[model samples]
Target: MEELLAQIERALRIGLTVVVAYLVALWLASIWWTFRDIRGRTTDIFLQIAATLLVAVFSFPGLLIYVILRPPKTLAQLYEESLEEEAFLQGIQVHNSCPVCKQRVEGDFIFCPWCQTRLKRTCVRCDRPLMLRWKMCPFCAQAVYTPGSGEAQPQVAGGQTSAIPQLRGADPEDTGPGTRPQIAARR
Candidate 1:
């Protein structure tokens, strides 16, 4: 009977030792997990050390408390969220853009401010801006005239002719004295 009791006590000691070792290993694992999780969520060194120590001292219960107080989103997730919000705000704001330079422009601008590309032509009769592709003015029923045509050209501000001068046949009547040729000089 005495020998049997001694064997039982020894078995109990072995089991107790295994349980203690397992608990210690679990406590260490919790500390490591808390440290890694806090590091991903924050950049502060003090917070990471505090979180690791909390888990190491109080084990699973401290880990639960840390989880409740920790930031919900990681640093990477916060950055991505901010980027998405910025893109959404940019999409919401509408801009009138120039086709040639893709720069922001006003609705009534005749030329792109950035590239100086001609956007519209002034109607000779009504002085309204007209699209290049339109055959006739929508505001006024006058027919639209394109450049290089022999018809009467449109006049711009300061009494300057807006059309590229007709160069097909030289008309002596068209080119009076002290006037340059109708040809466009290349740069």
Candidate 2:
């Protein structure tokens, strides 16, 4: 009977050793997973070390905690989102819109194409398109005469004057494509 009991005791010791070894291996795996997961999610050294230690200490429960608290988006996703936002902001900042018709217009456009509303006036000396409110021309440092500022109007064949504002290009004689309403004065 004593020999049989001694044999049973030896069998129990071997069983316990195997169980403990398996648990230790599983715990080590948990630690490694924690380290790898944290490294991929963040760039901070302290966070990676802290997560690894926590998972090692608590084993399975610590891994669950880290998974729940990690960032929802990956690094690549964050980068793409930032780029899209930057492009949208730049478009809003650079483009100019017409006030009368709310249509997008170029920077040097003298009048709104859709509304025929005079956006800017012609500069007297430099003959460049000037902004509506400016008293002086930016190109030639010359004073400008605003259209509605009660300036003298040259009469044609009869007493009628040119009511429609003419768009001048590089030279005063050159008239670019415009929807300017001009009346043919009778000779």
Candidate 3:
């Protein structure tokens, strides 16, 4: 009977040893996994080493801490998000652009060169640049007229034609011999 009792005790001791060994193996694997994960997430080698040691030294609790506090995104995910934000900003700039022909114009241009679409026009009375479709000039209390409305003329200066609207009768024959032409203002 004593011999049977001793055998039973030995079996129990071996089972307990196996269970402890399994737990130790699990702890070591968790540490290794933590090292691998942190390495993949960061370019810093010191961070990887520190994370590995932190989990390894504390056994199970350190792994719990790492799991709770690790970065939500991978390095690739962060880079993708940055690229998406840049693309979104570029889209906004494109949306605010004016060139009707999709050509880029420099610095406050009144008309597009390719499509000839009037981007902005100068107020006839005030000579201030105003956007198209304004009913009245904001700078001066003058009636807004469309560029091609048969009453507005291109005022020229020093061999350069200005986009300043001039409320004049349509004179197709008179391209104007000089810089500016004094013409009759039609109603």
* Candidate rank order under TM-score: 1, 3, 2
User: Where does the lowest 10-residue lDDT sum fall in candidate 3?
Assistant: 158-167
In terms of lDDT, the best-performing candidate is 1
- TM-score on alpha carbons, each prediction: 0.49, 0.43, 0.48
Q: After TM-score superposition, what is the CA distance of residue 168 in candidate 1 from its true location, in Å?
A: 51
Report backbone clashes per prediction.
Answer: 0, 0, 0
Instruction: Determine which window of 10 residues in candidate 2 has minimal summed lDDT.
Output: 154-163
Give Cα-based local distance difference scores for all models. 0.68, 0.64, 0.63
Scored by Cα lDDT, where does model 3 land?
0.63
lDDT per residue as tens, model 3, 39-113: 768878887887888899988899888877777677888899998776544422444344345567644566666
Off by over 4 Å in 3: 92-187
Q: Candidate 1's residue-wise lDDT over 25-117, tens digit each?
A: 998888889999999999999999999898988889999999999999999999999986665444212345666566877767777779776
158, model 3: CA deviation in Å? 25
lDDT of 2 at 124: 51
Candidate 1 structure lDDT: 0.68
- Error of model 1, residue 27, in angstroms: 0.3
